[model samples]
Target: MKIFSENITVPASAIDENSHVNNITYLKWCIDVAEKHWLSTAPKQFQESHFWVVLEHTISYKNPSFEGEELRVETWVTLAEGVKSERSYKITRISDNKVLVNAKTVWCYVELESQRPARITEEIRALFL
Candidate 1:
C-alpha cells in the first residue's frame, strides 16, 4: 500500500473549549490529506476528468492532542472496486507516538463533467497500489 503522509504543528485555533484539538479539525485534516494525495498521485487528465465525493466517513478518537504538538497525518487506499474506494487515515502525536485519531472514508468516484458515478480505471488503481 502507498501511504501518503504529512506533518503539522497543532495551532491554538485548532483547540476548542476543552483546550484540545477539535473534532472538526480532525475531519478537516483527513479530507485535506486525501485531496493532497490524489492531487499528487493522479495524472492531469485523470485530475480533469474525475473527482471523489465522500460517501461515508468514520473516525475514532484515542487521545487528545494539544497546541504546539507535532502530529503526523497519514492516509492510504484500503480497497477499491467498481465505483468506489475506501481510504484510511491516522493521526499520531510525534512526542509520544500515540495515535490521536483513526478514520476511514468511502469515496465515490465521479465523472467531473457528467456529475455521475464512474468506475475505477486500472490506471487509477495502479497509482495507489
Candidate 2:
C-alpha cells in the first residue's frame, strides 16, 4: 500500500484548555487530510464509482501538539477486505520529527442509493492504485 504524507500548521483555534491541540481536532485533521488527498488525486474516480465512509476510528496521542507547531500527517492504506478498508495515520512534529499521534480508521464502501455496505468495485480499486 502506498503512503501519502502531508504537513499542516497548528492553528491557535485548534488548541484546548491544556494548551495543546484538542483530541477531537486531531481526529478532524485526520479525516480532512484523507478527504483532501482523495479529492485532489482522484476527483473523477471518487465521484464516479464509490465513496468511503468512516465506520470506526482509533487514536492514540503520544505528545502534545501545541499552537504554532508544524505537523506532518502521513496516511497509508493498510488493506481492503470485503466491504471495508483500513487506513493508518502517523502525526509527527515537523521541527523535531517527534511522533505526536497514531490513528487508525476503518472505512466502508456504501451504495449511495441503498445506504448499505457495498463491495469495492474494480474501478474503485484502480483509483486507489
- How does each model score on lDDT? 0.97, 0.84
* 11-74: candidate 1 lDDT, tens digit per residue: 9999999999999999999999999999999999999999999999999999999999999999
Give per-model TM-scores: 0.98, 0.89
lDDT, residue 28, model 1? 99
Error of 1 at 87 (Å): 0.1
For candidate 1, give the lDDT.
0.97
Q: Write the residue-wise lDDT of candidate 2 on 12-52 in tens digits.
A: 99999989899999999899888876776665844566677
Question: Top TM-score: which candidate number?
Answer: 1
**Deviation in angstroms for 11 in model 1?**
1.1
Candidate 1: TM-score? Answer: 0.98
Worst 10 residues of 2 by lDDT: 41-50
